[model samples]
Target: MSKPVLTIFYQFNPWDSSIGGIQTVIRSFIKYAPDEFVVRVVGTGAPGSALGVWKWTEYAGKAIQFMPVIAVGEDNVRKLIPTTIAYGASLMRHNFASDFMHFHRIEPTLASLNWAGDKTLFIHNDIRKQMDRNLGGKAILWQQFPKVYFALEKLLISQFEQVYSCNSESAQHYREAYPELAPRVAFLKNGFDPESFYPDKREEREIKRRELAQELGLPETVRFLLFAGRLHPQKDPVLGIQAIAALADPQVHLLIAGAGELEEQVRREIQALNLGDRVTLLGAVNSDRLAQLYRAASAFLLSSVYEGLPVTVLEALACGTPVVTTDCGETPKLLSPDSGVVCKERTAEAIADALRRVLANPDLYSSEACVRTVQPYSAPSIVQEVYRQMLHRWQYRKAIAISSPYPS
Candidate 1:
């Protein structure tokens, strides 16, 4: 009789200011949710003040509630477990009225899976595997914790009523790791906001492009290649710089935006490659400026070896910019003959070839085709699918509850 209320549990990485794909999904669902449902977001705070809550209104239907828990110290395993458990209990008690609960990442709060009336966990990526893979060349301390984290994730996956992954790759990974729950996993594609990214006015685009180029000290004769995302090893930002180096075209410049732990390493690599003047490490450009960079660039490049579903590629296409990406995650699924190039390998030479081909013949891919390929990923369409499935499951559970007769 009454509309069900959906509560989302999301992780907040304070160091990251620009919203990521996972955060975008939470925001979209809240913004476009049907009138019948109520949506609330619960953000886990970064280490330090891990037990405070803040509320804010974001859009017409979505409300955000952020909780800060005491910060977990590095290598302090003794305190991590207790803090996670305490935070989970606090979150469960705070959102007691929610009819359904959705978690953005697999974390300690997932312990509440047993109490939430309806539960869904959206697997963005196999975090533990990533941590291990990316830490291969890093400090020994960083390598020790992924093993512990992976074990905890395996335990959490078993408790969910339903599991959703951003791409088929993630779904398969989960299925192989947890065969018992494979049948319950569903695929939910990531989407973009068309209103914010659709083709810009020609005059406006040109003017904005000029302004961006001037700000970045890019020359008018140079063709800009944009890579937008965290500057982390997992993203392979160094590979992007390597690709630009191989291009050896002084006329082409690579713009690396966003910051991360690998910043210093990437900078050293750029200099070693003799790309000091050619590669620009802009470091964490804001959303508005990022949109302008997308419009100005001759093409967008993604060097990630693994990803959930990169919303950046979709946003680039939505802005009518051709994209060049590796065959990582769902990138191949989103690309086509008209959109741009999709390479088979993550090597610098592979990416270099793709970039050369697109820049050589931009006429082959039209703005119309780029827009068409990314149309289904619009925020409204994707959110509608999420709501439909959630409501369907809720109804099925209600039916079962009514039919199951209590002991007489």
Candidate 2:
């Protein structure tokens, strides 16, 4: 007999891009899926033969497929709506063939909701709400957008046989926002690949450290503090820069490695603070380079005002680097006194203090302990749990039908 089909609808491609947490999660999922299920992914991209899809099919007897939806121009709005509708219509045609539809992000979930199919939706982040709040002075205009988006979120979630959230906070928010659907919501934390991110050997670490330092024109004595994510208003990279400035520790250098809409603004702030000599903005670093950076850094810092659950922190911990993060999203649950510092206040002073403390006392947490804490969050482990829960729910429903008096 053939394995069951599990179709995933995502607005973006993990293999084609290096965008933050979402891409990381999807790539890890593909890398570690079980052998009993066939995975097919549908994503959106630029129109025509110029656009191509990537497929990975090496997992035992399981198969993987990528179907791309081509768009017309640079303006995403012109492409998004039509591509989404087309994708949904196509999936509706094959509804009876698949066992389940799994949506990795919101837009696709909204698109797949009305289709005559069984589905599951994963709430990666409360992105629409985050965007509304981050838009600041334009909040009135964008705030209304989230209200509509959340309404759609609620509606789509209701249509799903099961809804999975990346963190407990999102689960609680969904429960509070829509009490009627609380029972269907389940928590499925994101995971990492230990082999890909685990600590490097001492020789490897030293070599990478020296090479990176020389390449970036850094003095051998300087200790680098790293932040790896988009420099957007939501991530608040300015806060990380300001925190370093507040410390006034010349030995501590800030290395930012990502891009976003606020790139120019972040550059302006660096110039204003006369931090050109102390900060290095590496634009965007690839996965291997990012892993090397994590191994070389004194600590990893995240200053986001909100998040679902950042995979970078897990990656950093897996690489044996301690983390200093704000109490954003599910971070507090992940951080213990043994792993890293979690700040209650979202200010430069608070972050600076946390960074200073972690730097001054690195041995307070054992790297091995930190790595062990995140073992349960590995990609294979998390995916296995997802499969178990899904199967259990399916069996329960089957049992109910078998016991019902009206059943054939």
For this target, which candidate reaches the highest lDDT against the unseen true structure? 1
Q: Write the per-residue lDDT of candidate 2 for residues 291-317, one digit (tens) a residue.
A: 888988878999987778888888888
Query: Each candidate's lDDT (Cα)?
Result: 0.73, 0.73
Which portions of model 2 show Cα errors greater than 4 Å?
46-63, 71-97, 126-144, 201-204, 391-408
Q: TM-score for model 2?
A: 0.85
lDDT of 1 by residue, 93-184 (tens): 55443678887756644557556477778877534445654534342233557777667787777767788887877788778888899888
For all candidates, what are the clash counts?
9, 1
Residue pairs with colliding backbones in model 2 are 47-71
What is the TM-score of each predicted model, taking all chains together?
Answer: 0.83, 0.85
lDDT of 1 at 134: 52
With candidate 1 superimposed using the best TM-score fit, by how many Å does residue 28's alpha carbon deviate from the native? 1.7
